[model samples]
Target: KIPEPAVAVDAVSITPCGEGFPQCDFEDSAHPFCDWVQTSKDGGHWVLGHKNVSIHGMGPS
Candidate 1:
């Protein structure tokens, strides 16, 4: 006889951001989140990018 799975599969539900937590879409502004700030200490910063990044075969298609 086959053994039953340890955990049962059930319906999944996702809670939208800002309801009880925070989220960022990185679409509207340079800053990703409300309290996020860019720093130059590492000589790199976060910037919004399109669906495809500059280099080919690197980013999402």
Candidate 2:
């Protein structure tokens, strides 16, 4: 199954993670709930596109 919802109707917006996106550094803001995080013998990280939502009381948090 696809892990996350593919589309959101009331999207707040899509923002680029910016110039050093996905590049690890000491100062990068931690994405504790990143959708594409994976773990195995060889660790991995991926940047999945995010659709911010502005609706209230719609889905479980």
Estimated TM-score for each candidate: 0.24, 0.19
User: Which tens-of-lDDT digit does each residue in 22-41 have in candidate 2?
Assistant: 44433535654433333365
Q: Which residue pairs collide in model 2, if any? A: none
Q: lDDT for each of the candidates?
A: 0.44, 0.42
Q: Give the TM-score of candidate 1.
A: 0.24
**Candidate 2 regions with alpha-carbon error over 4 angstroms:** 1-8, 23-37, 41-61
State how far residue 19 of model 2 sits from its true place (Å). 5.2
User: Which one is best on lDDT?
Assistant: 1
Measured on C-alpha atoms, candidate 2 has an lDDT of 0.42
| Candidate 1 residue lDDT tens string, 1-61 | 9988798769998866442223556675754453333347834454333333222222222
